[model samples]
Every structure is written in C-alpha cells, then in structure tokens.
Target chain A: MECLSDVGFSGATVGVVAKRAGVSRGAAQHHFRTREDLLTAALLHMSENRLAELRRRAADLPDGAARTGAVVEMLIDAYTGPEFSAALQLWAAAANDPRLRSQVIPLEEHVGREAHRAAVDLLGADETAPGVREAVQATLDLARGLGLASLLTDDEPRRRRVVGQWTRMLEETLR
Target chain B: MECLSDVGFSGATVGVVAKRAGVSRGAAQHHFRTREDLLTAALLHMSENRLAELRRRAADLPDGAARTGAVVEMLIDAYTGPEFSAALQLWAAAANDPRLRSQVIPLEEHVGREAHRAAVDLLGADETAPGVREAVQATLDLARGLGLASLLTDDEPRRRRVVGQWTRMLEETLR
Candidate 1:
C-alpha cells in the first residue's frame, strides 16, 4: 500500500516494496516470483484492509440523513488516503496494458461491487425505492471528483462544503 | 496522444511515438527536443481539441433538465474518447514526477475552472443559490465517476440509467 500509493504502480518495484517491508530481496522473491504476483497480492491486501475499516465504520449509526452523512464521510476519507492513489495508478496503467488490465479488471470489479453494497448497508438506504439508487451513486461519485481535486490542490474546505450540501440534498430527495 | 495514452507516460518512447506517427526518429527528436516537450505539446493539443468540442456542445438549449442532460452527454462523450485517456495518463504520472506535475497542474487547473464555469452557464443555474452550486458540482463529479467505471467495464446501460435519473433530480433541485 505504501509503495504503490506513495510512488505509483509503475514505481512499485519489488526491490522498493521488499525494502519497505524490512525483508530481504531473496525472501521477497521467494514469496512473490514476479511483479504481477506482487501487485495482485498488494491489491488483495488493500481490499481486506479496507473491508475491515468499513465494517468498523459501519458499526452503530442513527438512520436517515445522519447515517447517510456518515457513509459519505467514510467514503471521502477513504478516497483521500493512499489506497485511492494505488487504485488510480492501476486504472491509469491498465488503460493501455493488457497484461495489467487483465489482472486489475477483476480486482476492481469485485471491489467496486462490494463497496456499493457496503454503502447501501451502512446508510440503510433502500436501493429499490424510486430515485434512491441514483442518489446513492451520486454521493459516491461526487466524493470521487472531490478526492481527485484534492490531489492537485488543497481544496478540503470546498470539498467539505460540497459534501455537506450534497448530503442535505440527498436527504430531501430520498426521504 | 494515442502513443501516450495507449502506452503510458513511462512507456511512451520517442522511437515508438515516431514510428507510430510514420516519422523518422531524428525528425521527431528535432521537433520535440525531449520527452517532456513532446508530452506537453501533445497535452496542449488535446486541451485545444476538447475546448472546441465543449464550445460546440454548449450551444443553445432549453434551460432546466434538458440543458443539464446535454451537458452530461458532452461529459460522457468526452470521457469515451482519447482525451480522457491522455488526461488520465497525466494525472497518474503527475502523482510522482514533479516536473510533469508542474506542467500538468496549471493545465488541469485552467481546464477544470473553465469547465465548471461553462457547466454553470450552460445549465443557466444560479451558483449563489442554496444547493445550486453543489448541484452543478455534483453533476460534473458524478459524470467523472461514471466515466472511470466505463474504462474498465462495459457499463453503458447503467451509465445511461444513472444520467437520466441524475438529470431529473438536478432539474428539480436547481429549479
């Protein structure tokens, strides 16, 4: 996570990752024979780590706008972290590389689907209701845009304001 | 643009790009001088090309949801092309390379600010109003997320559904 996110996928050499993990190169090679093997393992590890965090965040929350706000907050925080950077690197790299694309597509697909399910569960929002599903997606989607903006500029204040505004609108529309 | 987007920033060799363009390596080097020079020039060309399309798409339309849908269509179309691929390349590369970051930051900043302005104008929505600003931002943000999803999956059916639903909500909220 640290290597991939901090330096990007292309920069995440086995040498760098092994050094970061405080392991010998030989040991690292023994565990993961190739770059693809290492990246797949890293991504799976990220998913597991994120799942644990989501479960923790999902614990005990009031329903309605309050719950929705918490879910959005969790999403915003996640996107602002190193994990997002790593996923972005994969997305960009996979755009052209069929080899990487083959590896990343399934990883991303499973993660994206699960995250959507988690968001609905955390918010206790009914996806079957009229317009509710789109509102749910809008919340996550807006968070992504705000997150990308943060990478280039320190627009946290604006991001927070937008999130607040969006949450309110979501409640009014969905409720 | 194809060379960079299809091969990535690191993989975009002068030899490959020149060969792809049916030009001699010597001639390509003479025109671009360096990889940075070539990438920057390519990015500028993409920006100009996109600006023209945005302007054309911003043409006269009925205010309210109709206008909102049109703008979203423009955004979706933009993402379904080479420009988005190139932009993604810059974003991924800029995360680590300070030199590329410096060149891209200003380019992205200008494009983002203008795109937001154009969106608000095209929608004829009052940015100073209660949730109008956030609605505008949300529209663009959501489109971006949908665009990213499209890169990996053939989710056109879901994308269309989301756009239609988002347009209705945005219409009601902005109005």
Candidate 2:
C-alpha cells in the first residue's frame, strides 16, 4: 500500500515491493503470482481497513448538530488518506487496463456501497425520504472531490470551510 | 487528448500522438520539445474547450426554478466528457511526478476557480451570504465526484438521480 501511494502503480514493481517488505522477490512471487494479483489483494485489504476505520470513527460521533459535522469530517478524512492515494493509483492504472478494470470495478462498487451505507447510518438518515439517499451520496461525492483537490495542493483552509458549509446544508436536507 | 483519454498518459507517447495526428515525429517535437510540453499544451487546449463549452451551455439555460436543474446538469456534463477523461489521466500522472505536479496544480486551480465562478454566476448565487460560496464549491465537488464515478462504469442512471436530488437541494439553498 505504501509502495503504491509513494511511487504510484507503474513504479511499484514486484522487486521494489518485495525489497520494501524485506522479502526476496521469489518469496513475494510465491505468495502473489503477478502484479495484478498483488495489487488486487492490497486493494481488498485497504478497503477493509477503510470500512473498519469508518466504523471506529462512527462510535465517537456526538449527538444532534455536532454529529453532522463529525460525520462529514470523518468521511473527508477517509478520502484524503494514504489508502485513498493508493486506491487512486490503481484506479488510474485500471482506467486503461480492461483486465485490471474488471477486477477493480466490483471491488470499488462494493466499497462505495459500504461507505454510503455507513454514512447513511452515521447521519441517522432515512433513505425512504425523498432526496435523503442522494443527499448522502452527494456528501460522499463532495468528500471525494475534496480529496481529489487535496492530491495536488494544500487545500485545507478552503476544504474546512466547504465541509462546514456542507454540514450545514446536509443538516437541513437530511432533516 | 484522445490519445491520453484512450491510452492514458504513459501510453500517449510522442510517436503515438504523432501517428494519430498524422504529423511527423520531427514536426510534433518541433512544436513540443518534451512529452511534458505536449501534455501541458494539450491540457490547456482542453481546459479552454471545457470553459467555452460551459459558456455555450450556460446561454441556453432556462429562467427561474427550472434553471437549477439545468445548471446542475450542465456542471455534471462538464466533468463527464472527454476533456475530463484526458485531464484525469494528467492528474494521476502529476500526483507522482513533482515537476508535472507543479505545472498541473496551478493550471487546475485556475480552471477550478473559473468553474466555481461560472457556477456562481449561472446559479445567480450570492457569495456574500453565509454558506453560499461553500455551497457552490460543494456543487462542483459533487459534479467532479460524479465524473470520477463515471470513469469506471456507466454510472449514468445513479448520476442522474443524484443530480436530480442535488438540484432540489441547490434550489432550496439558493432561494
């Protein structure tokens, strides 16, 4: 994961990952045959880690108005971390690689659905209500866009303001 | 741009681009000294095309309540096209390449600010009002996130639904 985040997909070769893991190339290959296999396994592991992190953060969220802010912040944090960075590398690679895209698309959908469910639960949103489900999805999308912005620059101050504003908007819409 | 969109940044070599453009390699290099120069030029072209496209669509938008949905659709359209696909390739490449990162970051910021300003103008939104500016920013972010989702799969159905929901929210917020 660190290899993917630090050097990107193309640069994270088997030998490099193996060396970084303090294992011989042959030993690494013994476990995961191809780079695709290794990457798929790593991404699956990262997805689980992200969900676990979301659940852990959900436990500490405060009640009422404060919960919206915390939930938005937590969601934003999920997208801005190294895990997202690694996933982004793989996503870019997969965009042009049909085989990798085939493997990645399902995993991404599963993770996305899980994240959306987690957000809906954390916000105590009733999806049966008109626009509530889309509001939650929009919140997640906004977080991801903020993450994309953060990839190139330190967009923290603007991001904080945006989050604050979205939290307010979400509070009203979800209500 | 098509080359980048179709094959990604690494595969869109000078040779491939030249071949696609029906220009000699010498002529291509004469215009762009390096791959970075070629990509930078292409990106600038793409950005201008996007903004011009936005303005053209903006002129056709309706008045009053219906405008919000049209604006949301316009913004979403801005991000889901070939220009965005080419830009995504560059963004992923720039994330790991410092030199490319420096060039792409400023260009992206400029484009983002332009898009935000355009959205504010189109929505007739008041930035002086509390949360208005952030609302606009979040709208753009949501559009971008929708774009990201479209990259891997045919997310049109869900994207349309989310846009519909967001249009309602924006109409309420801006009102």
Candidate 3:
C-alpha cells in the first residue's frame, strides 16, 4: 500500500511492490492472491500501525494533560513521517475507490472511537458529558487535517506551529 | 480544478472536463490555455463561489453569530458538495505535481486567512490573541476532515451529527 500510495495507487503494480519491499515476485504473489487483496491488506496494516504509534507515543505521559500533549506531538510526527505519507496517499486513493472505502470506513470509525476514549482518559473528563467527546474528537480530527495539509505543503515551521497550537487548544479543554 | 480533482487531475483529461461542463473542446481550450491553468482557475473560482454562498447564507443573520454559524454550515456543504469533491480529487493530483502545488497552496492559504478573519470578526476577538485564530481554523479544518471522512463512508447521520457538534463547539469557543 505504501508503495502504491506513494507512487499513485491505480498505477501501482504487484511487481513494483515486490521490488520495493525486497521480496521476490513469487513471495509477494503467495501473500496477496491479487492486486486488490494487496491493496486491502496495506490499508488495514496502515490503520493498525497508526493506532499503535499513537499509543506508543502516549505511553509515558502522566494523564490526560500529558497524554494530550504526547498525542498531539505524535500525531504531527505521524502525518509528516515518511511512513504516514504513504498512508495518507493510500487514504486519498481510497477516497476514490468503493472497494477500498468499504474496507476503510469501519477501521476509521474504530480509530475515532479509540482516539476519543484516549482523549477522555487523558483529560479526566466524563466521557458522557454533553459535547465533550465530540469536542475532543473534533480537535483530533482538526489536528489530523492540519497535519495532512501541512504535509502536502512541506512546510515544517507551519506544521510545528499548528501542532503546538493544537496541543494548547486541547489542553484548554482540560481547564 | 473541480473536474480535474473529481476525476484525479492527472487521470482527468481536458476532454473529460469539457464534456462534463457541456462546453466544447475548443471553448475549454479557449478559457484555459493548459490543463494546469484550468485547475488553478477552477479552484479559485470554486473558492469564490463558496465565499459568495457563505455571504448569502449569512445575509439574514447579524454579523458575528450569523457569520460563524453560516460559514460552518457552508463549509460542511462545500466539502460534501459535488463540486468540492472534484476539487478534492484535484487536490490529490496536485499532491503529485509541483506546479499544481504552487497554485493550490496559495489558494488554500487564502481560504485559511478568510476563515480566520471571519472568525475574528464574528467572535469580536483580536487576531493576535495567542491561540484564537488557530483554534477557529482548527475547528473549521476538523469539520472539513470529518465531512470528507463521512463522504467516503456513506454515513448521513454521522455527517449531520458531526456538523452539528462542530457548530456547537465553535459556539462554545466564541463564548
């Protein structure tokens, strides 16, 4: 998926991914019976990778405040990182593919739920409070958007500033 | 740009757009000397159209609250609307083209500026307030992201709820 998204998904061939991943074409074939299967697996892999990365980044943080801070920084890094760029590109490709959409939507919802839960735990807020989860999720969603937009522009300073502002804004909810 | 974006800018031939817009090939060529030019012009044109729609929507309401409310709704509509989907597809294409990026980046910045300005005016907040602009822009960005995500999933209720939550969140920020 990374190779395909990075280079353009529709044009991504099995041979390209095999070569890129340093695996034999036969080995690649064994793993993915078809191109569509490869694409599906890659998308799922990326979603899982992102969630794990978020958790790893927030692991050392003390609570909601620390977690919010850590999560913002991690999210910034995630969006701008080489790996996540591939993921973002895949997401763009999925936006245009119905098969890809079916695979991606539920994962997306699950990720949103996880992030919301984390934010609640981090902020020490009541998960059921009116607008609380929604507000926090909105902040998370906004951070992801800004991060992706900044990545596209290759603007590091802007990315840092946006991330910093987001961390601060999320922290505000704690107060 | 909408046509190009809708179809994947690189994949979208000028011929397709001319056909989609119901204009002659010659007419399309006449208005846009090159495909790149057409894309730039299209995105600018759409932004103008969006701004115009926003103005009309907010026309009945008082300046601050009305503009805030109306702009958020307009943004929701714009992101989910047909034309913007095309523009978004073009955005993906632009990600791969440096020339297209040059055209898109500035326009994106302009929209961000316009959004920030509107928020400031509506909230009666100073632009220089440390995090005010960032927060407002972040919320708008969040709405757009959620809108895009919702579109990919065919979730109308999720879309409606997020849009409402977004408006209410912004309302809280202003207060």
Candidate 4:
C-alpha cells in the first residue's frame, strides 16, 4: 500500500515492494512464488482486512436492513478511505493481465456471494422475488462502480451525497 | 493504450510513451502538455470509440426493451473489449493519483450519463418511475461490478453468462 502511494499500480514493482519490506528477493520469492502471487497475496490480505472491518462495523446494527445499510456505509468508506487507492491499483492490473485474473477473481466471487447473501437474508427476500434480487445485485454493482468513479476525484461532498443516494435506494427497495 | 500494454501502468513514463509513439519528447509535449493530458486524450478517444460502437449495436433493436437489452450487451462488450483493459490501467492510476483524477472523473461521469440517458430514453422512463430509473441505474451498476470482477478471471464463458444474467434482469425489469 505504501509503495502504491508513490508510484501507483503501473509503477509498482516487485523489487520495490521487496525493498520496501526490507526482505531479500529470495525471501520474498519464498513467500510469493511469482510476481502475480505476490500481488495476489497483498490484495487478498487487504480484502480480508477490509472485509473483517466491514463485518465489525456492521456487527452492532440490528437486522438485515441496518446491516445492509452498514455494509453500504462500509463500501463508501472503503472506497474513499485510505486503503482504497491500492485496490484501484490491483484492479488496473487485473484488467489486462490474465495471470493476475486467476488469482483475483475467486476472491471477488467469494466476497460477492457473501455480500449477496447478507442482502438476501436482511430483506427476508425469497427465491421468487426476482425483482428484489435484481435490485440487490444492482445496488452492489452500482456501489462498486461509484466507488471507482469516486476515486477519480476527491469530492467529499459528492461522495457523501452518493452514499446518501445509495442508502436511500436500499431503504426504498426494502420498504 | 500502447504504453499500458508495454508497461502495464506500473513503470510507464512520459518519455517512454513519447518514444513508443515515435514522436520526439518535445513533440509529444506539444500535443499533450502533461502526462495527465495525454492520458485524458487517450481516455476520451477510447470512450468515443466505445460509445460509437454501442450506438451502432443498439440501433437495430426493434423496441424499447430490446434496445435497453442491446445497450446492456454493448456495455458488456465495451467493458470487456480490448480497449477497456488499457483504459482501466489509466483509470486505476487516476483513482490513486489526484493529479490524474481531475481528468478521469469528468470523463467517467460523461460516459455514465450517456449510458444512463440511453437507457432512460429507450425505456421511455420518466423521473417519476423511480423503480424503472433505479432499475436502469442498477443494471448499469451491476454490469460494471461484474465486468470488473470478470477481469480477474479467465472464465470467458462464465463472464458471458454473468453478463447474460444481467441482460436478463433488464428484460424482466422492463417487462
């Protein structure tokens, strides 16, 4: 993440990360078999961290709606927060690199499934409510896109407004 | 895009892009006053290309539903198309780099509005149709998330299937 701050994704290098971590090339290799492995590890580590944090943030909330709201807030925070920029870097790499995709996709799917389940459970949505399901899926989709778009600019007020819009959508859907 | 392909956005330099473009550094500077300017030009160029193709793809559809569905399909194609990955590299750069964000955000918003408006016009959706508007926005949002998620894997069939699911949702929503 530190290295990403200076050079961004296209500029980040394994050598630079290794040097920054104060580990030798061989040591880094032992931990990550390849450059893709190294990046995947770093990304997964961050995802796990953020996921855990999201759960923690939502823990105190009452039910699925509140939990969903909490999760939406978490998404907004994750995107605009300090840890977000590195994710942007990882995404950039994954966009074109097939090798990186192998490592990154499963994690995302896992996260997507988890988030979807949370939304489903929270709304008491049944298998038959395809419309609700679509809405939930769409909410997740828009949040991700908006998150990336938000990073393109540092508009705090806009970010806040977007988050509010997201929250409103969730509420309206559930109601 | 060439620079992104060659260097994957990690180590690409303005000097390198100029060299690859077969232009003198001064000449490159003359066209793009800064690296960000070059990136902005590249993004705009690609967005235009993608939008034009989308317009053509959706033009032949028989009705509003079909047109909307076509737009979703076009979105999937535009996003997963070869140009998209390259654009993503710069997008990632912009997400983390404030200097780059200034250029990236406006372009994103422009393209987003274009897509949304197309969907609205095709659906004949008015502001009062919160459900329809939300549905349109939701589908676009999910397609984005899925597209980004799809980039991390080599499952072409599954990616298409996932996009197909989204297209299906649009059909159902319109119905």
Summarize candidate 1's per-residue lDDT along B1-175 as a digit string, tens digits. Answer: 8888788888888888899999999999999998877887888778777767787767666565577788777766666556677777777788777887888788777777777787777778898778888777777767666767777667778777777777877777788
Clashing pairs in 3: A64-A122, B5-B89, B5-B90, B6-B86
Which candidate achieves the best lDDT against the true structure? Answer: 2
lDDT scores in order: 0.76, 0.87, 0.65, 0.65
Could you give candidate 4's per-residue lDDT for residues A41-91 as a string of tens digits? 786787677667666655566675565566666565665544566766766
Give the higher-TM-score candidate: 2 or 3.
2
Residue B143 miss distance in model 3 (angstroms):
2.7
| Candidate with more favorable, higher lDDT: 1 or 3 | 1
Q: Candidate 2 at residue A7, lDDT?
A: 87
Interface alpha-carbon RMSD, every candidate = 1.5, 1.0, 2.8, 3.9
lDDT of 3 by residue, A1-175 (tens): 5675457666677888899899998999999987767866776677677767666655577764666666667655654555555555556666667777677677667766776676566456664666656656665666556655764666677656656666765566445
Candidate 2 lDDT over residue span A45-87, tens digit each: 8878877888887888899989989988988988886777788
Better of 1 and 4 by TM-score: 1
> In candidate 3, which residue ranges exceed 4 Å CA deviation?
A63-67, A118-125, A159-165, A172-175, B62-67, B122-125, B159-169
Alpha-carbon runs more than 4 Å astray in model 2: none
lDDT: worst 10-residue window of model 3 chain B: B1-10
lDDT tens digits by residue: candidate 1, A8-80:
8778888999999999888999999987778877887887688679878687766656887877888777776
* Runs off by more than 4 Å, candidate 4: A10-39, A64-80, A94-139, A154-175, B10-30, B33-35, B131-135, B155-175
Whichever of 1 and 4 has more lDDT, that candidate is 1
Worst lDDT 10-window in candidate 4 chain A: A122-131
- Candidate 1, what DockQ? 0.63
In angstroms, the error of model 4 at A17 is 5.3
